[model samples]
Target: MRRHLRKLRSTPAVVLLFLILLFLLPYDNSFSPRAAIVSAVPALFEKRWWLINKPGAYPVDFSQDVAVLVKSGIGTKERIPSWLQAHEHMELSDLLLIGDFATLPGQEYQYRDQRLPVHDVLAWMIGRGYMAEDLDHPRLQKYYNLTRAIDREDVGAAQEMSGSFGWELDAMKFLSGMELLYSRFPDKKWYIMADDDTYLIQPSFKRLIEHFNPNREQYLGNPVGGEDCRFGHGGSSIILSHRAVSHLTSDREYLATAYRESLDETWGDKRLAVALNRLEIYIYEEYAAFFNGERPRTSKITKERLCTPVLSFHGLSSSSDMLSVSRTFEHATEQVLWIDLWNIPTSDKSDNAHLPKASTSLFDDPIYDTGHANWDYVGRPDEWTQSVEDVSSVETCKQICREERPDFCLAWTWDSNEKKCHMSWWIIKGDQAEGRTSGLNVPVVKGLVRSCRP
Candidate 1:
C-alpha cells in the first residue's frame, strides 16, 4: 500500500514533466506544437484587433457635423435628431423609382458576357417596391416578346448612349418618359432617376436624403455647370422632391416647350437641366459626393471624396461591377472622414501615399497666384480637409495632386504659415470661406461648365 501511494505521488511529477517537454521544447524532426501555439498567439490578437476595428461595425461619429447643424438653429430651438435616428428614418419604401432604360431590352454590358445591366437592375427592382409603370421605357409590349435569355436575339450595342451621335431617338425617349412618369406618379414623395448603367446603394442613398423633407422643393445631385448654371450629372442620377416635380407639371405650355427643346439638345443631361432651371429648381450641393463619375475598379478617389456613405456610381457598366460595388459598400467599409458638402476627396488615399515632411515650407510659391490661369479657384479651405504635414511647399502640393491623384485632384489649398497643403477632389462653392488660398483643376472645371444666365 505504501509503495502504491509512492507511485501515485510520482505520477503527478511525471505528467508535469511531460507537459513541460511538450510545450517548451522544440523538435527538428517534426512540427513543434509549442512553436505553433506561440506564433498563433500573436495572430489571434491580430484577428481580434481587426474585428474590433472593422469598418461600419460602429455608428459614425458626426459630433462636429451635427454641432454645425445645431448652430444654424440658434434662436428657433429646433430639435435635432441623433445620427442614429436620422439613419433609421431612411427606409427602402420611402423612395419612388424612375430608371432610364434603352428601348432595346437586353444588351450585354461592357465587361461581362452574360451579365446585363438592364436585366440585373430590373430583377433587383421587381420585389423592391418600385412599380413597372414608374420606370422609363417601361415594357409596353415586351420589345422582343422573349422572356428568357436563351430566347433573345444577338447582343446589340455594348452601352446605350443619348444626345448627339445620331442617338436623338434615345434622348427623346427619355424626355417623353419623364413627362409620362411625373404625370402618372406625381404625388410620390421623392422620385429617384437613374440610367441602366447606374447602381444605387439604397441605404447610402436613403441616408443622404433623410435630412431633407420630401414636401420641400429640393433638387439634389452632383453640381455641374460651374458657378453659373448648376445641374446634377444625370448619369450619376438625380433625386426630385414632390415640390420640384410640381413645377414641371403645374404648367402645360412650359412642359411642352421644355420637351420640344430637349429633343434637339446634344446632351440629355443638359436638356433636363434647362427644363428644371426654367422652373427655378436649383441643384442642392450637399449630395454631390453621392455622384461618382469613375468607372468601377478604376480608382479609390470617387469613394473617398464624397465623405458620405457612397450613394450611387455612374460608370458601372457590367453586372459584375454593379454586384461588386453593392457588396463592397453593403457594410460601411469606410467612415465618412469629412462632412463638408463639397471640397472632399472622392475616395480615401492609399495608406502610405504622402507623409508630412517637416514644419518648414519647401517652396515660396505665392499662397495665391493670379490662380492657375487655366484653373478656376473652386473655393477652399476644403471641408474637414486634412493638411499634408511634411509637404513643405505649394509645388510639392501641386506635384502630389498631379502625380498621385491625376483623376481626382480637382483643386487644392495651401497654408504658408502652417507649411501645409490640402487637396480637394470635389468642391462646393457654398462651402467657400474667405481669406483661404486656393487653386482649381481648370480642365475639370471647364468640362462641367454649362452656359447659364449670369
Candidate 2:
C-alpha cells in the first residue's frame, strides 16, 4: 500500500508542471492571476499573505546577487581536493569557510581563507578567516546536518581550547565568516550556507536568491526550527535572509540565550529545532513531513513544472556510485514533495540546563521574549503579561510559578477554579533528573494560567 502510494506521490514532470502552472496562471483575482486560475482551489490559498492571488505576473528574480559559505569540520586530504576546485568552474564566488581552520595532524591546513596557490588567483580566499576542516563520518550522525570532522585523537584537545565546539562553534564561525566575507565580497547580495560534506550544486545561488527577494518577503529556509526541529540544527544548507542574519547576531541576549539552551543535557539540533519552531523562520525541508508527525512519511518531487525551488534538503539514490553532490541535485531535478510541518518545531523551545522549565507559550508571557539566536527566555513580562490578557478577560490573578516539579505538588492546597494559586517552574537541573521522569523537563510552557500545572 505504502510503496504504491509513494510512487503515486512522486508525480511525473509534465503533470507536475501542469499543476504548478495551474496554480500560477492568471485568474479573475489578485496576486498571481495566471497561477490562481489553474491548479489551487482559491479557498486553499485564502489567507496566504504571501499568496499571489491578485491579477499579476508570477514573481521574478529581481534579487539576483549571491554568496556561498562552506562549513568543514573534517580536513580536505581526501574529498577536499575535489570541492576546493569545484568553485572555480562554477558561477559562484569564492568558498567561504567556517569551522576548525586546520584539521590536519601536526600541521593546521589554512582553510580559513581558501589556500589555492597565490597565482592560483582563488588563493585569495585564504586571506579571509573563513575555513573548513576534515569532517569524519560518525560525528556526522549525532546532530542533524552541521559537519564535525576532527581527529578522534584530537577531539578532546579541540574541546579543551573551546568547550565551544560542534554546531555552536560552526555557527559562530559562519557568523564570523559572513561578517568578514560581507566586507570583502561587496557585490555579494545574499549568502548561501552549506557544510564541507555537502555537494553544493552549481547556480544554487540564483535559485535561493529568487526565493529570498526582500520584496517577496516570505520567510526563507533555516527560518528557525520548531520545538522538534531545533534552530540552526534542523538541516544543513540553509538559505538565510540578510535580515535574519542580523536577527540572530544583533543581540547579545540572543547569543547568550542560544548558548545556554544548546548546552542543555538533552540539547542538540533537534532540541534547538523545537525552540526555533516558536521563532519566525522556515526552511525548504524534506524530512519535515516524516519528522513532524505528518501522516505520509514519503513524497516525490519534479522540476520543470516550475515548482518553487526554495531548496531541497534530502534525496534518495540507490546507486552506490552517486556522489552526494550529484544525488542532491537529482532530488532538485524532481518536483520535491514537501512535508509541511504544522510547527517548525521554529527554533526557540530547547530544554534549559538549570531553569526548571520553559513555558510552551513564551510569547504569551509579558516578560517572555524571543531572541535572534532563536531562543526565548523570561524577560520580565511586566504588566503587559497579565494586564492585556486580563483586560481581555484572559487573566484574573497574575502569578508566576517557579516549581522544580509538576508532580512535586501538595495537591490539596492548589485550588483550580479560584485562581488562588498560579505557579511557574524554575528548572534547577535536567541532567540530574533524566532518570526520574523529568529527564528532559524544563518548564515546558508559560502563559497567564489561572492555576498551576494541571
Best by lDDT: 1
Winner by TM-score: 1
Steric collisions counted per model: 15, 96
- Candidate 1 contains a number of clashing pairs equal to 15
What TM-score should be assigned to candidate 2? 0.38
Over 4 Å off in model 2, which ranges?
1-64, 75-78, 101-187, 203-205, 215-219, 222-236, 265-454
TM-score against truth, every candidate: 0.43, 0.38
Candidate 2 accuracy as lDDT: 0.33
lDDT of 1 by residue, 8-103 (tens): 999999987875666543222133354455445433322212113334312222311111000001111111112112222222322222222322
The alpha-carbon lDDT assigned to residue 395 of candidate 1 equals: 70
Supply candidate 1's per-residue lDDT for 313: 59
Question: For model 2, what is the alpha-carbon lDDT of residue 318?
Answer: 19
Model 1 lDDT, residue 191, Cα: 65
Per-model C-alpha lDDT, please? 0.44, 0.33
